[model samples]
Target: MKKSGLISVVAFIVSVIVTASSLFTASGDPFPGPVMIAICIILPIIGLLAALISNKGALKFIGFTGNLLILLLSVVVPAVSTLFWNQP
Candidate 1:
């Protein structure tokens, strides 16, 4: 579970960076952002859940907090920035 949780955390961070950074590219498209954001949310969530189930002490709380940050950063911020505020 620890190994799997670590893997999920890495995947989640990478996906979040890739997905969020895509917004700044010249070829940016809205088509893939939501899907990738969904992936980012899922990966960290899985890690958090696994950590909780495995009784890994600090890992569980840290995983949850980190996952929440990832979710906000990779999903909510981009979404609000694009959909609500008209900023480029």
Candidate 2:
């Protein structure tokens, strides 16, 4: 396989693993419930698509976007959720 193909495959695998780990690591969860399961399943596919579309030359750009999205969803989403759910 070409370098780009290898990179894309690696990116897809890494993204899927990270997503799975995060979903499975939540304190109260043995398995991710339906919604989390869906997100975990979908996000890596999206990341793979992004990586494929951008080509290996733009892998960094695709990675940055993926990381940013993960950070936003994992950090910002929970903080905002806490504010609303735990409001005075």
Residues 1-88 of candidate 2: C-alpha lDDT, one tens digit per residue: 2354445545555655666576677575444577554454455555556555554455645554564566466557878889889655
**Pairs with steric clashes in candidate 2:** none
| Per-candidate count of clashing residue pairs (backbone under 3 Å) | 0, 0
| Range of the 10 consecutive residues with the lowest summed lDDT in candidate 2 | 1-10
The reply for model 2, stretches above 4 Å from the true place, is 1-16, 24-56
Tens digits of per-residue lDDT, candidate 1, 1-88, equal: 6665565456556655665666576877444756764666676667556555654555555666677777787668878878787755
How good is model 2 by TM-score?
A: 0.42
Indicate the residue-level lDDT of 57 in model 2. Answer: 51
Model 1 steric clash pairs: none
